[model samples]
Target: MDTRDLGCGYDFEVENSGHVFEVKGLSGDNGGVLFTDKEWSIASEKQEDYHLVLVKECFSNDPVVEVYSNSHRKFNPKKQITTVINVNWSISTSDLNYTEIN
Candidate 1:
C-alpha cells in the first residue's frame, strides 16, 4: 500500500475498520521512520483513526512491525523533519488494528 506517488496523503485506507495506515520500511541500522510535514498535515486532518506502521529490520528475513495508533493526533514531536514518531498515549500493538493483507 505504500506508494511512491506524492500527495495521496497516506498509504492505505482499510474499509473494514475504517482505519488508515502510513507504512514505512527500514532496516534496523537506519533507526525509525520519518514523517514529513506534508504527511503530518494530512494526518492532522484525518486523525480520527490513523496509524503509522514501521517495518523495522526490513532487510532481515523476519521484519519487526511497530504500529503506532492514532499517532498523528497524539504527539507534537517538534517540527523537525527527522524526529522519530511519538504517540502521547498507550496503545497495545494488538490494539493498533489493521486490515489483513492477502
Candidate 2:
C-alpha cells in the first residue's frame, strides 16, 4: 500500500484491490477523539496521536478498525496535522474435490 498527499489530507491505496481510503485530521485537541458515523466508529483516546479509520460494511452494519502508530503528531504551533494509513489485505482459500458413491 502507498499513500499520497491529497491537499486536505492523505489518500491510501491498496496494491492488490486498488481500493483507496482517506484520512483527515479533526479540529481540536487530539485527546478523547472518537470518529463517529452511521456506518462505523473508531475511538483513539488511549493512543493520543493516531488516525481513525471508519469503514461501512453494509447499509446498517459497519466496523471501525484502528491503526495505531507514533508517526502522527503536531509539527506546528497550531497543532494541525494529518496522517495517512495504508493497509494491505490478503486472503487465501483452498478447496478439495472428492467423489462418493452410495
Clashes of each: 0, 0
Model 1, 61-100: lDDT tens per residue? 8888888877776766677645588769777777666645
Task: Tell me the tens digit of each residue's lDDT in model 2 across 1-102.
Answer: 446543323246455653344454433323233222310211222234334343333233343344433223321122334687999975444322343334
lDDT agreement of model 1 with the native: 0.74
TM-score of each: 0.61, 0.23
Lowest lDDT 10-residue stretch of candidate 2:
38-47
lDDT of 1 at 76: 66
Task: State the number of backbone clashes in model 2.
Answer: 0
Clashing pairs in 1: none
List the candidate 1 regions with Cα displacement exceeding 4 Å. Answer: 1-6, 81-102
lDDT against the true structure, per candidate, is: 0.74, 0.36
Tell me the lDDT of model 1 at 29: 43
Candidate 2 matches the true fold with a TM-score of 0.23
Give the winner by lDDT. Answer: 1
